[model samples]
Target: MSKLSKLSLITLFFWIVKIVATTLGETAGDLLSMTLNVGCAVSSTILIGVFLANLVTRLLSKSCN
Candidate 1:
């Protein structure tokens, strides 16, 4: 119930979400590469751009904390 405990719980949840997101992203990128007949380097570059765009959008949104 303490602030420190609450913050730790939130931090832990964020880390869990991050891991899941990265795993999903990696899987999707590989699937996309195979479907598009692209190489790993190209696929990674495209995925990175997509991820960054989403991150920027999310950070800039008014609802973001």
Candidate 2:
């Protein structure tokens, strides 16, 4: 396969994976807050922690590069 084709296929696969993961996360979040009674406040705090961790990792990676 050509390099372009391979790269395109990889990109498409990554996009599909991202979509599936996002959907699963949303569903799980609702289930936690509604069914498990986790509450929006706790969920939001957890999500904020995740966001901060991701932001820090991205900043560190970019600086390293």
On lDDT, the leading prediction is 1
Supply candidate 1's per-residue lDDT for 12.
100
Candidate 1 stretches greater than 4 Å from native: 59-65
State residue 38's C-alpha deviation in candidate 2, in Å.
Answer: 1.7
Q: Once model 2 is optimally superposed onto the true structure by TM-score, how far is the C-alpha of residue 52 displaced, in angstroms?
A: 11
lDDT of 2 by residue, 2-25 (tens): 999999999999999999989987
Q: Which is the leading candidate under TM-score?
A: 1
Candidate 2, position 43, lDDT: 76
lDDT of each: 0.90, 0.86
Q: Which ten residues in a row have the lowest lDDT in candidate 2?
A: 56-65
RMSD of each: 2.5, 3.4
TM-scores of the candidates are 0.64, 0.61
In terms of TM-score, how similar is model 1 to the real structure? 0.64
